[model samples]
Target: MNSIGVVYNNNHELHDYILKGFPSPESPARLKRILQHFVDNRVLENNNCKVLYPANVSVEDILRVHTADYFSFVQSRSLSGGGWLGNDTYLCEGSFEVLLQAVGSVLEAGKAVVTGQCDHAFALIRPPGHHACADKHSGFCIFNNAAVLARHLQHVYSCQKIAIVNIDAHASDGTQNIFYADPSVLCISVHQDPSDFYPFKGFIREMGSMPALGYTVNMEMPQEAGNPEYSIFFEEVGLKVLEQFCPDLVILECGFDSYYKEKLAKLNLTVDGYYDSVSRLRSRWHTIVLLEGGYHDDLGLLADVVLQALADNRYTKDEVNQVNLLASRQSSCRRIFDNKLNELKKLMSSYWEI
Candidate 1:
C-alpha cells in the first residue's frame, strides 16, 4: 500500500483580503471547502493517506527562486499596511506569515517524497503561486511555491533532473521564466490557449532559450477542449516528451480551473480528464502535487480525485458522463485542439523523436 503524505493548514486564512475592497475568489473559503470535504469523506481514515504537519521554512528557502530585494519589498509592504500588489493580487498584514506556512508545507511534502518517507505527497496550499515571478507577485500568488520546492529538492536532497508539469488554466509563465535557461529542470505547461487567456503566453513556439532548448514545453488547449482532447494530448505528446526527459521527480502544478464548471476559464476538462492525466504521470514518476488555481465548488472533489489517483486507488466512478459531456461541447473545440496538437508535435519534432 502506498502512503500519501498530506500537508495543509487553515491559518492560510490570515492572508485573506485585509484592506482590499473586493472579495477575491482566492479566499480562505477555498481551503475550507477542501479540508471539510476530506473530513466528510473520511479521506484521512484511508489506510494509504496520512496527514503531516510541516515546519515553517526560513527566508533562505524563499530566496531559492525570488530576489532578496523583491522579498524585502513584499515584507515591508505587508508589515506597514496591506494594499494591492497589482490589479488581481492583494496583500494583508499577515500575508507574509501565511506565505511562509504555504511554502513550508510544500517543502515538507517534497521532503517526504524525496526521502522515500512517502510514495506521494500533496500540499493543499494557496494563494496559488504559479503566477508569481522571481521579482513580483501576480495572479493572487505571492511566492513561486513549486519553483522554491523544486530548488529545495535539488539543494537538500541532491535530487537532480526535476520536472514541473502545470495543468492550470493559465500559462505557467512565471515558472517557465525562472527556469527558461536552466537545463537541469524541465518545465511543461499545458493550459488554455493564451491567445485570449490571462497571462497571454505559453504559445507552442515558446520552447526554452539556447543551451536549454526544448526543456520548456507548452501545449495550449483550445477553449472548451474536454476529456477526449486532454487524453489524446497526453498519450500522443505529453507522455512521450516526459519519457524522453526522464525526470527523477515530477512536481504537478495541479489546478481545478480546467474543470467544466469553472467560471474563469473556457476549457472543459471533467473529473475523468484530471484523473487520467494525473494517473499517467503517477505511473511514470513519484509526484508532489501543489495546489495552484480553481475556484469552483468542486475543488474539493477534484483534489480528492488527484489524491486517490496518486495513491493508485482508481476504482471510484466519475460523477459525470464524459462521452455525453464531450458531445455537448462546441464543435470548434476539438477542431482547434487538433490543430494545436499538430503544431506542438511539429515544433517539438526537431528536439524530441515525436
Candidate 2:
C-alpha cells in the first residue's frame, strides 16, 4: 500500500454562509461529516496514512495567480461584513482567513507528495477553488487552489511540468482560464456538459489557446453518464493526453458531486468509479487530491473511497449496486456520450496522438 498524507483547513467553519443568514449548499457541515467519518472509521490509524494541518499562505503566494486588487477586494469584503460576491459565491466575516487556510492546506498537500514525505496527499478543504478566477470569484470558489499550487511548485520546487485533472460535476472553468495559454500546466476537466449548466464555459471547442493549444482538455459527459462512460473516456482520451504530457505531478480536483446521490448535477459515479479513476492515476504518478465540489450525505463515504485508492487498500466496499445503476441509465445517454466522445477525439487528434 502507498503511504498517504491528509491536510485540511481547521478554520473552514468560519467561511459558513449560514452565519450571513443565507441557505447555501456549500457549508461547514460538508467537511465536518467527512472528518467525522474518517475518525469513526479509524482511517488514519494505519501506518501508511498521516494527517497534517496548514499555516496561512503568504500574500505574495496568493498574488501569483490572483490580482493584487482582487485580493484586496476579498479581504475588504470580509472585513466589511461578508455577502455574496456574485456568481453564486458568498463570503462570511472570516472568509478571507478561510481562503488563506484553504489554499495553504492544498499547497501543503502538494509539498507532502513532491518532497517524498508521502506517496500521495489529499487536501480535504472547503469553499472549492476550481471556479474562482484571478479577478473574480464564482461557484463558491474564492482562490484557484490548484492553480496557485501549480505555480508554487514551479516557483519553489522547480518542477518543470504539472497536470491538473478535474473531475467535478461542474466544469472547471476558472482553472482552465488561468492556464489556457500556458504550456507548463496541462489541465483536463471532465464534467457534465455545459450546454445548459451553471457556469457554462467548458466546451470541447474551448481548447487552450496559442502556446498551450491542446494542453487544456474538456470532456463534457452527458447527463446520466456513469462509470462506463468515464472509464471509456479516460481510456480513449484523458489518459492518453496525460501520457503524452508526462507531467511531473498530477493534481486531482477530486469532487464527489458526480456520485449518483448528488442533487446539484446529473452525472452518476459510484464508489467503484471513483476508485478506478484514482487508482489508474495513482499507479502512474505522484498525485495530490484536492476536494472541489460536492454537497451530499455520502461525501464522507466517497472520501474514504479516494483514500483507499491512494493507499491501494480494499477496505471500502461499493454499497451501490453497479449492475442496477448501469441498467437504470437510459440507453439514449450512452448514444449521446458516444457522439460527444468521438467529436472530442477528432478535435484532439490534431494535437495529441489521440
Candidate 3:
C-alpha cells in the first residue's frame, strides 16, 4: 500500500473571507468539512495514511513564481484590514499568515513526495491559487501554489520535467500564464468550457507560446459533461499527451467543482469521474495533489474518493448512478462535447499524435 501524506492548513480559519463583511463560497468551511470527514470516518487512521506538518516557507520560496512587488502588496494588504485585490479576490486581516501556511503546506507535500517520505501527498489548504498570477491576485487566489511547488521541486529535488494537470471546473489561467513560455513544465487543464465560465480564457487555441508550443493543453468540456465524457477525454487526449511528455512528477490541481452537484459550474463529474481521473494519473506518476476549488456540500465525499484512488483502494459506491445521471442530460450536451473533443484533437494534431 502506498503511504499518503495529508497536509492541512493549521490556521486556515484566520484567512476567512466572511470576516470581511461578506459570505464567500471559498470559506474556511471547505477545509473544515474535509478535515471533519477525515476524522469521523477514521481516514487518517488508515494504516497507509498519515498527517504531515508543514515548515514555514520563506519569501525566497514565494519569489520563485511571484514578483517581489506583488508579494509586498499582498502582505501589506493582509496585514492591514482585508480588501479586494481586483477580480473579486479578498485578503482578510492575517490572511498573509494563512497564505504562508497554505504555501508552506503545499511545498511540504511536494517535498515529502519527491523525497520519498510518502508515496503521495495531498495538501488541503484554502484560498485556492490556480487563478493567481505572478503579479496579481484574482479569483480568490493570492499566490500560485502549484507553480511555486513545481519550481520548488525543480530547485530542491532537481526534477527537471514536471506536469501540472488541473481537474478544476475553472480554467488554470494563472498557472498557464506563468509557465506558458517554459518547456520544463507541461500544463494541461481539463475544465468546463471557458466561453461562459469565470476566468473565461482557457480555449483550445491557447496552447503555450513559442518554444513551448504544445506544452500547455486545455480541453474545454461542454456544460453537463459528466463521467463518460471525462473518461473519453482521458483515454484519447489527456493520457496520450502525458505519456508523450514523460514528466518526473505530476502535480494535480484537484478541484471538485466538476462534480454533479456543484452550483458554480454545470459539469457533472461524480465520485466515479474523480476516482478514475486521479487513479489513472497516480498509476503513471508520483502525484502531489493541491486542492484548488469546489464549494459543494459533498466536498468531504469527494476528498475521500480522491484518497481512496491515491491509495489504490476499492472505491466506495457512488451516491448517484452513472447511467441514470448520463441519461438525464440533454443529448445536445454530449453532441457539444463530441464537437469540442474533435476540435481539440485537430488543434493539437500538429503537436501530438492524437
Estimated TM-score for each candidate: 0.97, 0.98, 0.98
lDDT per residue as tens, model 1, 148-168: 999999998998899999999
User: What lDDT score is found at residue 308 in candidate 1?
Assistant: 83
In terms of lDDT, the poorest run of 10 residues in model 2 is 46-55
| Candidate with better lDDT, 1 vs 3 | 3
Please give the range of 10 consecutive residues that has the lowest summed lDDT in model 1: 14-23
lDDT of 3 by residue, 1-354 (tens): 789999988899998877887667899999999989888887766627878888689899999999999999888888888776668788889899999999999999998899899999999998899999899888988899999999999988899999999999999999999999999999999999998889997899999998999898999998899888989999999999999999998999998999999999999998888999999999999999999999989999889889988888854787888788888888899899899999989988889889
Q: What lDDT does the true structure give each of the candidates?
A: 0.88, 0.92, 0.91
Between candidates 1 and 2, the one scoring higher on lDDT is 2
Model 2 spans with C-alpha error above 4 angstroms: none
> What is the per-residue lDDT of model 2 for residues 295-324, given as tens digits with 9 covering 90 to 100?
999998889889999999877778888788
* Candidate 2, pairs of clashing residues: none
Give all candidate RMSDs, comma-separated: 1.2, 0.9, 1.0
Q: What is the lDDT of residue 308 in candidate 2?
A: 90
Candidate 2 CA-lDDT value: 0.92
What lDDT is reached at residue 43 by model 3?
77
Supply the TM-score for candidate 1: 0.97
